[model samples]
Target: MNTRGFYDELADRYDLMYADWDASTTRQGRALDALLTTSLGPGPHTVLDDACGIGTQAVGLARLGHRVTGTDLSPRAAARAAREAAARDLALPVAAADMRALPFADASFDAVVCADNALPHLLTAEDVRAALAETRRVLRPGGLLLLSTRPYTALRRIRPTSEAPHVHNGPDGRTITFQLWHWHPDGERYDVELFQLLPSGGTWTTHTSGATYWALPEEETARYLREAGFGEPVLHLPAATGFHQPVLGARRPVPHTRSTL
Candidate 1:
């Protein structure tokens, strides 16, 4: 299935995949906030969480007092994000929209964030460029863009059969989340089956969803950003940034024109 349907099916269990979902929100929010403050010069600025899944970043940023908007391909995810924002008393505007073409007017946001390896969802260089171009279109001149992705350089070297499962125990008992990857021979694309196993009374219940993504290396990500009209993209590591994944910082430079002699 496509990403929208895959995520839609897992909306209820998505949060369960994380060890400490609420803590992750705060941590991720702070990391993005720091990048924004340094690259975009302190906000109170309008921000867009383009691939916001269940308000993880949106609501947290809103809590920090920035105006935020969120959008996801899945209607169910977007609705959950909005509801989660409200539950936290943060008013965030979220909708179901494709990342390739955002519904906002040109130059609308001061900054844009696509966290949690969102860009690779496109699965092709052309699609990735289209999404980046659209992101650039909605940003104000000199806008900051923050993105995070897995370090595929290492990932590609070890084409593992499966990822380590994230298992958590709660009042309901145990919930185990993991992914199985079927890599394409090209080495840059993988079909991912996300599985969530939950304790159902006496036995365990399993739910599976599948999707695909292109494995984006830092080099390719930077090249596409520049091709899409972005300025130099700076790479930030988790060691330096305290973020879950490696981050990239880029800017929409001011337009320049030749002067008449």
Candidate 2:
């Protein structure tokens, strides 16, 4: 499946990927809010979640009082995010959009968040650069940009075939989520088959989705951030940030103004 199809198929069940979806959202929100505050230092900044899949980060950030707007390639996912936000009495406007070409004005936001291993979905250096360029264009001068992805450095070495299954026991009994990876010969890209199995009477119901991703290491992503006109690109490991994945933080540089003689 393609990117949009993968997410669209998984929209309603996306939260099932988390053992405790609500708790995970809150925890992730807190961690990300702290990161944003530490970097920007203020209240209620305008933020854009460029790859907001079902509002995983956007909803949490919105709850923290940031004015957040979200966009996703999957219309169903974006719609689900809006519904999720509304259910919480939060105003999180979301649209279906591609990160490579955001549907917003220039300098439209104070911060842009591309979390949850989203950027790697581009699968090519040029595509990644285009997305970053769009991210930079939408941010105000010195606007913060944060992105998260798996630790590709280690994964590239190990090239694991599958991920450990995540088990969640809820009102509906038990559900298991896991992924099987098929790496390309290049070692830099892979196709993922995401599977979720749920209890159904005596049998189990299985749902699967697929997508391709480039194993974008922090060093490579940081280089793209710089080449896209962002400055001070820094990688924050999960050990330091308490986040699940490595977070890369950068800022759109303030354009230098020439003084008249």
| Top candidate (lDDT) | 2
Instruction: State every prediction's TM-score relative to the real structure.
Output: 0.97, 0.98
Model 1 per-residue lDDT tens digits across residues 66-137: 899999998998899998888888899998999998999999999999988889999877899899999999
| Ten-residue region with minimum lDDT total, candidate 1 | 36-45
Q: Kindly state the number of residue pairs that clash in model 2.
A: 0
Candidate 2: pairs in clash? none
Q: Name the candidate that leads on TM-score.
A: 2
lDDT of each: 0.90, 0.91
Model 2: per-residue lDDT, tens digit, 177-252? 9999999999999999999999998679999889999997778888888888899788888888888999999998
List ranges where model 1 is wrong by over 4 Å: 257-261
Whole-model lDDT for model 2 versus the true structure?
Answer: 0.91
